[model samples]
Target: MIVFFFWLSIFIIVYTYAGYPALLYLLGKACRKTKEYEDYEPSITLLIAAYNEEDFIRRKLDNSLNLDYPSEKLQILVVADGSTDKTAEIVQTYESRHVELCFQPQRQGKLAAIDRAMAFARGDIVLFSDANNIYEPGTLKSLVVPFSDPTVGGVSGAKHIIKDENTLGESEGLYWKYESFIKKQETRLGSCSGVSGEIFAIRRALYEPAPRHIINDDFYLAMRLLRRGYRIVYVPQARSFERTSYSKKDEIIRRKRINAGRYQALRYFRQIFPLKYPRLMWQVISHKVFRLLLPFAMIVAFLTNGLALVPGLSKGEPSILRLTFPFNWIIFSIQSLFYLLSVIGNISAGKQGKLVYLPTFLVNSNIASFQGFLQFIKGNETALWEKVKRADNGEQINA
Candidate 1:
C-alpha cells in the first residue's frame, strides 16, 4: 500500500505538469478551419474597479481615454470601492462628462462594486480592467473585433508583463508567455480555460452578477458563459502592459488570494462538465483542476517517497520503485537540495537569489497554493483583500 500510494502520487505530479501539456500539444495538431471574424464595434462600457489607487488613477484614465476606439461608442466607468484616499477625488475629476465614477461609502469588495456599477452601465458589451494595467493604444480595437463571431461569447486580451531585470519580473513575464500559448491552444480546441481579469470583454447581456466573495471574477464570468455553450477567445494582439511584484512576498500575497478563489471556484462551479462538453471537461481537468490539486500531490509524493526509502527487508526492489535504491536516494537528494535552495532564496533578496529564480518561483507558488487551501478550508477567504505594495510601475494587481 505504501508503494502503491507512492507511485500514485508520483504519477499525479508528473501528469499534472508534463503529461497534460503534452496531451494538449497533440490535440492542438488536430485543428479545424479557422473562422474569419469581421470588424465589430459594439457599445462598450470600460469598467475598471479601483480601491485606493490615487497614484495610478490618472494614468489609468489617460490610457483608457486614449484607446483607438470611437469615443462616442465607448463609455469609461471607474468604480471606487470604499476608497478613503485621494483615489475618489482623482476619479471624480473625470466624472459625468468623460468617465463615470461609482462611489461606495463603505468597502464592499470588487464584485459588489461591479454589481452596483453594472446598474448604471448601458453598453452592449462590458470590458473589465485593472487600475494599474495600461492598455496599448490599439487594445480596444483588437479586443472587440472578435465579437463579430457570434459563437465567441467573450475575449481575453494578452497581458504583457514588462521586461524588468529583476528575477521576479522576468519569471512572471515567462510564466505569462507560457500561459498565453496554452490559452491559444485551448481556444483552438474549443475555448480558453478562463479569461484574464485585467482585460477581458463580455457581452453585457450575458453578464451575470458575481457572488459577493468571488475570488476570480474573470474566471467566474467566462466559465458561466462556457457552461451556456459559448467560446471565450484569447486575443494576443490586444494587450495590457503590467509590471511584476517586487519580490516573492508580494507575489505570494496575490497568489494566495487567487488560489483561495480557485478553491472556491472548484466547489461553487462543480458542474463544469455537462454531457455535451467532454473535450472541455478534459481541458478543464487537465488545465485547471489538476493544477489546483498539484500542491497537495507534491506534499503526498514527498512524504511517500521518503517512506519508500526505509530499510526494505524484501530482496528485490518493487517494480513501482523503478529507480535503483542509490538512484532513488540521489533523486530525493536533488529534490531536497532544490527545496533547500528555495528556503535560501526566500530569505535572501531577489538579486542575491537570481540564480534560483525558477526553483524558488515553483516552490513559492505551490506553497501559496497550500496556504490558499488552508484559507478555503477554514472558510476565511474573501473577495476583500489588502492590495500588496508593488514596484510602483503598475505592479501587482491582485492576481
Candidate 2:
C-alpha cells in the first residue's frame, strides 16, 4: 500500500509537469503541417469590452486605428458595460474615426457586453481584446493570417507581459513566457484548449452567444469552436502587451477570478474527457484538466512524502529507502524555501529592485487557486468583471 501511494504521487507530479509536455512535443512534431493559404484577406471587426476603463480607452482606440490591417476591411466596436465613469466618453471621442461606441446603462456581465458588441460588428472575423492590453502594430494581420485555412475557426495571440523594475513584473513576464512556450507546443500538436482573453479571433459564423453566467467567455468560446470541428491556432507573432497587476493583493484577486473560471470551465466542458472526445481528449486533458489539478497534486506529493518519512511506518526497509530519505527532506526544504520567497516577493513587490521573484509569484498563484476553489464551492464566483490596477510606462493607473 505504501509503495503504491508513493509511486502514485511521483507519477502524478512527473506526468503533470514533465511527461505530458514531452509527449505533446513528440506528437506535435509527428503531425503533418497544414498547407498555408496565401490569398486570404477577410474583413475583421475589433471588439473591445470596457467597464470603467477611462484611463486606457483612448490609448486602446488609438492602437486599434493604427493596426496594419486595411482601414476599409477593419471595424472597431467598443462596448462600455455600465461604466459610471468617463469610459463611455473616451470611446465616444473616437466616433468620427470609424469607431462605434455601444453603451448600456445596466451592467449584465462581460458575456452580455460581448454579445451586445457582436450585434454591431459587421465583418467576416471578430477579434476580441481587453480594454487595457495594447496590441502590437501588426497584430491584426498576424492574427488573421491563420484564418486562411478554412478549418481554422479561431486564433489566439501571444500575451507579452511588459517588464518593469518590480519583482512582480519580472515573475509575471517569466510566467507568460513559459505559458507561451507551452501554448506553442500544444498548437503544434493540433489545438490549444484555451487562449488568452487579451487577444483571440474567431470566425463570425462560429460566434455564438455565450451564457450570461460564463466567467471565462474567451475560453468557452474558443473551446466551443474546437468542439464544433474547428481548428484553433496559436499565432505567436500577434502580440498584446499589458502590465502585471499593481500589487500582490491585486494579483491575487485577478488569479482567483481566473481560477474560478477554470473551475467553471471544467464543469461546463465535462464532455471533453478521456472517454468522450477521444481524438482531442489527450490535448484537452494535458493542457486544461491537468493544469487545474496541479496544485492539489503538489499537496498530495508533499503529504505522501511526509508519511513515508515516519520511522515505524516503513522501518527496516531497503538501504535504498534510507538513502532516499534525505532526498525527501531536501525536496520538502526546497518547497518551504519557495513559500518563504513567495512571502518575501509579496512584501517586497513594490519596494524591491529585484528582477526575478519566481518563488513569490508561484506561491501566490497557488494560494489564489485555493481561494478560488473555495469561492467556486460556495457559489460566490460570478461573471462580474473585477478590474486589476495597471501600470503604464512606470506609472500606475487608477484601474
Candidate 3:
C-alpha cells in the first residue's frame, strides 16, 4: 500500500512538471485552430493601476503614450488607488497629455481600482496593464487585431522578462520561456488557460466585475469568458516587458500571493474541468491544478517513502531483484539527496548554476505555495499586498 502511494505521488509530480507539457506539444499538433486576422480597428481603453508608485507613473504613462495606436481611438486611464506618495500628483500632470486619472480616495485593492475604472472605460476593447510593465510599440495594434475574429473574445499578449545579470532574472527569463511555450501550444489547441495581466485585452461587452477580494484578477477575467464558451487566444507578437524580482526571497512573496489566488480559483472553477470540457480541462489540470497541488503531494510522497523503508531497514536483510539493498531505502536516499541539494542551492541563491539553482527554486516555490495554501485556509491573505522591492535601476516599478 505504501509502495503504491509512493510511486503514485512520484508519477503525479513528474507528470505535472515534465510529462504534461510534452504531451501537450504532441496533442497540439493534431488539434489545431485556424485564426483569421484582418485590419481591425476598435477603440481601446488602456487601464493602468498604481499604488504609491510616484516614480513609475511617469514612465508608464510615457510607455502608454508611445503605443502605436490612433490617438483618438486610444484612451489612457490611470487609476491611483489611495497612493500616499506623489503618485497622484504626478498623474494630474498627464491629464493635459490625454491621460485620464481615476483617483479613488481609499486604498481598496487592485481589483477594486479596476472595477472603479471599468465604469468610465469608454472603449470597445479594454486592455489592462501594470504601472511597471512596458508594452512594445506595436503591441496595442497586435492586441486589437485578434478582435477581427468573432470567435476570439479575449486576447492575452506575451510577457517578456528584461534580462540582466541578476540571478533571479536569468532563471525567471527561462521560466517565462517555458510558460510561453505552453501558452503557444495551448493557443494552437484553441484558447489558453489565462492571460498575463501586463498585456491582456477583453471585449468591454463581456467584462464582468471581478470580486474585489479576488487574488488573480487576470485568471478570473479570462476564465469567466471561457465559461461562456468564448475562446481566449494568446498572441506572441503582442509583448510587454517587466524586470524580474531582485531576489528569490522577494519573488517568493509574489509567488505565495499568486498561489493563494490560485487556490481561490479552484474553489470557484470546479465546473469547468475535464468532465465538462475535455481539452480545456486537460490544459487547466496539467497547466494549473497540478501546480497548486504539487507541494502537498510532495509532502505525502516524502512521508510514504520514509515509512515504507522503516520495516525493511529493521529486518536488516531486505533485498530487491537479487540485490541486498531494498528499493524503498534507495528511493528514500535519492529523495534525501535532492533535499540536500535544495539546501545548498538556497545558500547559493543569485548565482547562475542551473543544475543546483533549479532544485532550490523548485523547493522554495513549493514551500511558498504551501504557506500560501495555509494562508488561504486561515483567511489571512487580503486583496492588498505590500509591493516587493525590485532594483532601483531607473526602471519605474508598478506599485
Best by lDDT: 3
lDDT of 2 by residue, 344-375 (tens): 76666254433327767776887788788888
Residue 185 Cα positional deviation in candidate 1, in Å, after optimal superposition: 0.5
> Model 3, residue 263: what's the lDDT?
89
Q: Against the true structure, what is each candidate's TM-score? A: 0.93, 0.92, 0.92
Q: Name model 1 segments beyond 4 Å from true.
A: 270-275, 313-323, 350-355, 393-399
Model 3 agreement with the true structure over 1-399: per-residue lDDT tens digits: 665666678878999888988987888887775566898999999998888887677898988887789999999998998889999899899889889999978999999999999998999999999887888889988889989988889999998788767766766777788889888888888889868987889999999987788888898888788877888898888988888886778888999999998888887876433345677877887898888879978988899877766645334355542123467678778889888888887776456577666677788889989989998999987889759876448855332
Give model 3's TM-score versus the native structure: 0.92
Worst 10 residues of 1 by lDDT: 313-322
**Tens-place lDDT digits, model 1, residues 100-204:** 899978998899999999998888889999888888888888899888888888999998887666678777776788788888878777788767898999998
Error of 1 at 344 (Å): 2.9
lDDT of 1 at 390: 62
Number of the top TM-score candidate: 1
- Which has the better lDDT: candidate 1, or candidate 2? 1
Clash statistics: count for each candidate: 0, 1, 1
Please report, in order, the local distance difference test score of every candidate based on alpha carbons.
0.81, 0.79, 0.83
